[model samples]
Target chain A: MSSLEKRLAAEKRFKFYGMFAMTLSLFFVLILMYKIFSTGSGAFVRTTINADVYFDPNFIEVSSNSSKKEIMKASYVDLADQVINQNHPGLDEENFIKVREMYTRKFDYQLRDYIVNNPNVIGKTVNLDISASSDLDQIVKGNYPRNVPEAQRKINDYQLSILDSLDSKGKMSKTFNFWFFTNGDSRDPETAGILGALMGSFYALLICFSFAFPIGLLASVYLEEFVKPGKITDIIEVNINNLAAVPSIVYGLLGLGMLIGVFGMPYQVPLVGGLVLGFMTLPTIIIASRASLRGVPPSIREGALAVGATKMQTVFHHVIPLSLPGTLTGTIIGMAQALGETAPLLLVGMVAFVMEIPGGAFDPATGLPSQIYLWSESAERGFLEKTSAGIMLLLSFLIIMNTVAVLVRRKLEVKW
Target chain B: MVDQNSNYALQTSEVYVHYGKKMAINNVALNFPKNEVTSLIGPSGCGKSTFLRCLNRMNDVIDICNVKGKFLLNGNVDIYSPDIQVETLREKVGMVFQKPNPFPKTIYDNVAYGPKIHGIASSQNELDEIVKDSLHRAGLYEEVKDRMDDIATGLSGGQQQRLCIARAIAIRPEIILMDEPCSALDPIATAKIEDLINELKENYTIIIVTHSMSQASRVSSKTAFFHLGNLVEYGETGKIFTKPDKEQTNDYITGRFG
Candidate 1:
């Protein structure tokens, strides 16, 4: 063949190779999406019991007349017993108590109060489909392998039999889990939800946005737009670039030492976690924001200046609006990175087994990643499913954030 | 004979631009006549563009670039004075780059950007008028009038260049600098820009840097020839093109060694 013919063949082969590579990439991405969806979609639904538990007036009066602290201590078990008796009226006392104990080891004071205040509820049974323990719920949801040995399993054949009976009677089902939103962390895998972690993550992200946005944007503006490139500016640029590449866990260590150990900040709190995550995310935001700011052509700046705009006015009024889409994209990406980070929060003592949603920034609680890590480490088989569910939640958040970034980029894209 | 004092538009006396330790433009002294096209013609790397940039203090944007010269604008005002704002200096001397760099925006927005930022237009109607007039002056309105809202990047190379020229003119600069403005355009577009330049000379002083000797002859009244960081000759374009003056200038115009 002639050289030109050979070159043409080579060009054709190269095009074929590019197509093959693109196809393979698409196939792999599809597989990944399929796996994540199949595994994670199940996490959104949870098996719950639907039965009416009549509130006992005598129990409430007894609890109220006693010391407030004493009543609080007994409330969980007391409510559990009342609920069990109301659900299974003919069951023996021992079996009824055992069923109540299976639901929650602690007192539920809130349940007792609802029974006492509503006089109409004393004899009338209120429909209460309380969340089952994670182990039992997992078995009902077909997540737990039924072949596991009875001794090794937290929920035995006897409990599974009861659950099966409940299912047969149409008392158990997978419902849209409102408790998942309302409840806090629980040692019982069935009762555990991300409400506490969500609150913690919210406060931490709030702190990150508040602290990082201004500082990162200002640093980027100065570096990219305003500051005269000199030795000092060069040093700052290098430092910022290096900081972006630094491992986020190091920021956690810094937070552990300075914020908690040195500064006497509370450990396992959203406030400290926020500060740590902010430091970790700051460099990312700055680098991204700087690139966006720099992306604005010098002609635009020159144009603004020529129109007799002051440097500040030109930058703030014209340059910033143009660069905002890029900055927002960067900021969202940074927030997404912060969302899935576990190592830094681990170092800052944010992996505590928190049983209540954080009341404030200073309240001790775990974030989503930290909660996932915490759940994965537990010996309970129920937590394994919970961990999978938590992974789904975290991944969904990341996907949402990235989608927002993409949309913002498209919206703000200047077609120069 | 041209009068010596017709309020000189721009004057440079022994101007030197150094990049680090290396001198880029050495002891260049020249005057730009008002309301006329002054073209700087040279071989590559001769600092013609560098000197054009100096007129607007654009070299200040570069970190390592240092300019040492007493340059004056409009006879007595020192352009390089510390008190002169770089932004304000640039306002009076607008520049069109070698490659058309219309902002990634609608043709209308591209033209209106300068006017909006400068606060030259108070209302949308005023801005629309300015954009239309600027585009008309740049010889781009007729072709692009129907699609003014389309992205400037979608236009042909010559059209985009004209749009950039329109963008520059919208700011109402006194002196417009063209840095090889027709380098990226075809012969047809080049002719159109030359025609526009001739018309523009009535309202603005134009200094154009070009590598084409024919382009310099066609557009400029006066031409300055620069060679290897030195000004070889400055005279009327007709005299420089035909008459014997500098051996190097004659050789260059006759297509000998640049």
Candidate 2:
């Protein structure tokens, strides 16, 4: 063959190799997306219990006739007991008490209201479908091994029997979980939700936004637009690039030492979490912002100057508006990365076993990743599924945020 | 053809430019005519484009660039004076770069950017008129009028260059500087730009830097030749092309050696 034919063969081989590489990369990305969705979807559906239990009129009538509001509150537990007894007539005293415990611990006042409002229907059956305990729910959902030794299981044979009965009767089904929204961290995996972590994350993000946005933007402007490119500026640029690659967990360690240990700020609080994440995300924000600012051509600056615009005016009016989309996309991506980070939160005190929803940023709490960590370590057999579910929730948030970034970039992308 | 209006639109005396410790342009003194085209011709690395950029003080944008000596405009104001703002000087002497450097924006936005930044137009309608008129002057309006909102980058290379020229003209500058405007253009586009330069000279004083001696002869009223950062000759374009002032200038125009 001629040399030209050999060159043509080589060119064809190169094209084939390029196509193969692209296909391989796309395949891996698709597999990753599939795995994340498959593992995480189960966390959104929760098993609930549906049953009809009689409400006794005798307990309700006494509370209704009482003048004092305090006496009316005493009937709450009595109503719960009546419902349990009416549902499981053949069960022994201990078994009945265990069944009664399945109702929400916060539903006492709600039970009392139901009894007082419906005295006529107290003896009659009232159909109620309530959230099952996480362990029992896990058993019904086949999360717990059916063949496990009775002694090894957290749920006893009796509770399993009750769950089995409920399942056979088609009274146990997965429902949209309200507890995932309203509840907080519990020693019980069934009671765990992201409310505490979500609040903490929000507070941390607020702090990050306040600190990172202005500082990062200003630093980027100075580096890209204002400062003369020289030895000192080159050094600063190199340091910023290195900072972006620094381990986020190191920032957590730093925050733990400085913000909490040295500065004497409250531990397990969002303020410190925010400060750490801010430090972790600052380099990313600054790097992205500078890149976006540089993306604006020198011609725009020259054009503005040629029209008698001051440096400040050109930057604020033309450069900022053109770069705003890229800046926002960077910020969202940074926040999303911060959202899924567990190492830094672990270094800080976000791993506390918080049982109640945090009221504010300063309120001590565990975040979703930390909660997942907490659940995975529990001795309870049911917490494994809850851990999986928690991971799912965290991953979904990241997906949504990244999707928004992609959309913003596509919508506002400017080409020169 | 030195008109009465041929007072110094721009003047440079003993001007020197250094990049770090290395001298780029040395002791250059020249005058640009009002309402006429002055073309600077030289081989590569001869500081022709550097001399053009000096009129608008664009060298200030480079960190290592340092300038000394007098750069005056309108025979009175020294543009290099401490009190003179680079922004104000650039406003009077608008520039078009070698490669068309239109912003990553709509053609309308690209043209209106100058006027909008300077607040030359009070409203959107006025800004629109200014953009239209400038495009018309740049000889680009009829070709691009239907798609002014399309991204400037979408245009052909020639169209993009003309859009940049329109962008510079929109500022109502007294002097226009072209830095190898036709270097990246096709022969047809170069011809169009040459025609536009001739038309522009009727309203604004124009200075251009070109490596093409034929281009310099065809477009310019006055010509200056530079060799190794030194002004070798300056005279009427006709006399410089037809006759001879210096052996070097003659040899250069005749294609003996750059």
Candidate 3:
């Protein structure tokens, strides 16, 4: 064969290899996204049952003049027990326990809140939308396979019978689960939500952005613009690049030792998580920012200087504006990376189960990634879907951050 | 504005420039007579552009560049004095580059940038008038007045160069330095800029660097010819073009040597 023909054939083979690799990567990403969406989409729509809760006047002594604290401190679980007993007439004690298991632990709190919020509803039958427990929820949502026998399934025979009864009665309703978005981490996956972790991630990212954005940009500006190249600069450059590649877990360990151990900062607080993630993200931002600052044309600087602008004015007015898009993109990339980081957070104690949403940076918190890790390690069978759901939340946040960066780049980047 | 017809606008004595021990501009003494055009003509790397940059201290941005000279402006002010800010020096003398570099802003803003930085205009109305006046003086107002809000970079090449000239003129400098300002233009654009320069010399003293000998003869009153970092000839443009003073200058003008 002619050499030209041989070269063409070789080129075609290389092209095929590249295309195959790209297709393989895209296929895996597609499968991963599909798997995550399918498994986690079910978590957002929970199965609920309508319990005809009759508020007897004797049970709830909440008068119109009663203060909110007095109304809250009163016990109202007996009203829920009365409704359950009144509805299930022939159920014995053993079967009644299984019926009680069908309702969420917060059922009484729901009834009390309804009564307190609407004091005029006394002696009226209030149809409270009671959330089914996770086991019955799984069965109603079709997660618990009906074809499987009682011995083989995680749900016991009594629980299945209760779920079957609720299903046959047509009282079960699938509704959007607002609690998943509003509640805190819990031992019961049924009550768990991402609000605490989301807030924690926000606080951590706020700290990361507030610190890393300026410090990283200033360090880059100083190194690239002010400092002259020499052995020291070379060493600094090499160290910064190497820091960007350092194992993130080491930063976690550093935070564990320094911030929590020596500095006595509170563990699992977004403050310490933020500081550790800031250290991890610093090199990334600095490297990206320096590269962008270096990309500006020397002619622009000369132009500004020739116009009698001082060095500081030229940088602040011209250079900063021009490099802003890249700077923002780099910061977002750093934030997204910090958001998904779990191992470092684990070391810094962000893996602890937080019951309340963090009120501030110093409050105990768990990030989304840490929450996912915590759920995945739990022995409860219900936490499997919860872990996948947590992962979906984390991925959505990352997607949002990246989309914002792309939009900023498109809108603000200058042609020159 | 000084009434003395023979007053010199700028003077340089024993000026030397070096880049880390390599001489870029050798000891050279030259004078720019007030309210007239002076042209520096040389071959490639003859330090003409280097000499042009020295007037406004543009080379100060480079760390390795070392300049030593006595520069007197208006026959009294020592430009290289310890207390003389480079910003003030640049404000007194503006520069046009070889490549037309308009900031990535509107044409109006390009002309207004220097004035805004120096606080020459106190209000929006005054700033607009200044931009209009500067653009009119640069001979760009007629073509660009309707689209002053457009980005300066979107203009044609020669228009962009004229916009840069307007930007320089907006500073109201006493002297303007042009470093081959029309070298990147076509013959037609070059002709337009030459006419503009001839008209501008009436209001501002100009120093221009060019490799085109014809350009030096057409636009300048006095011409300094440089060769190998040294001034080989400094004389009236008519005499320097016709009468031979230095062998190297003659050879360069006649295209026999560079």
lDDT, residue A135, candidate 3: 76
TM-score of each: 0.83, 0.86, 0.95
Ranking by lDDT: 3, 1, 2
Model 2 chain B: lowest-lDDT 10 consecutive positions:
B1-10
For residues A147-261, could you state the per-residue lDDT of candidate 2 as single tens digits?
8888877577877778778678888777876656667776655556668777777777787778887788888888888887889998998998898888888998999999988
Per-model C-alpha RMSD: 5.0, 4.6, 2.5
Per-residue lDDT of candidate 1, residues A1-416 (tens digit)? 99999999999999999999999999998887777667655556666677777666555544334554544445445556767776766777666654654454433543654544543455456776666666666677677778889887667776777777887999986777655567788877656788999899989998888888888898899888777778998898899889988888999999999999999998999899988889988999999888888888887766555445677977887688789899989999999999888989999999988998998898998999999899889987667756777787888889999999999999878766
- lDDT tens digits, residues B1-258, model 3? 222334899988789999889998998999999889999998899898888888999998888989998888988778888889999888989989998888888899888889999999999999999999999998989999899899888998899988888898899999999999999999999998999999999989999999789999999999999988999999999989998688888888899987
| Model 2: CAPRI class | acceptable
Better of 2 and 3 by DockQ: 3
Per-prediction backbone clash count? 5, 1, 0
Best-fitting candidate, scored by lDDT: 3
Among all candidates shown, the one with the greatest TM-score: 3
lDDT of 1 at A347: 96
After superposition, the stretches of candidate 3 with alpha carbons farther than 4 Å from their true spots are A146-154, B1-6
For each candidate, the alpha-carbon lDDT, in order, equals 0.82, 0.81, 0.87
Give lDDT tens digits, candidate 2, residues B174-234: 9999999999999999999999999999999999999889999999999999988889999
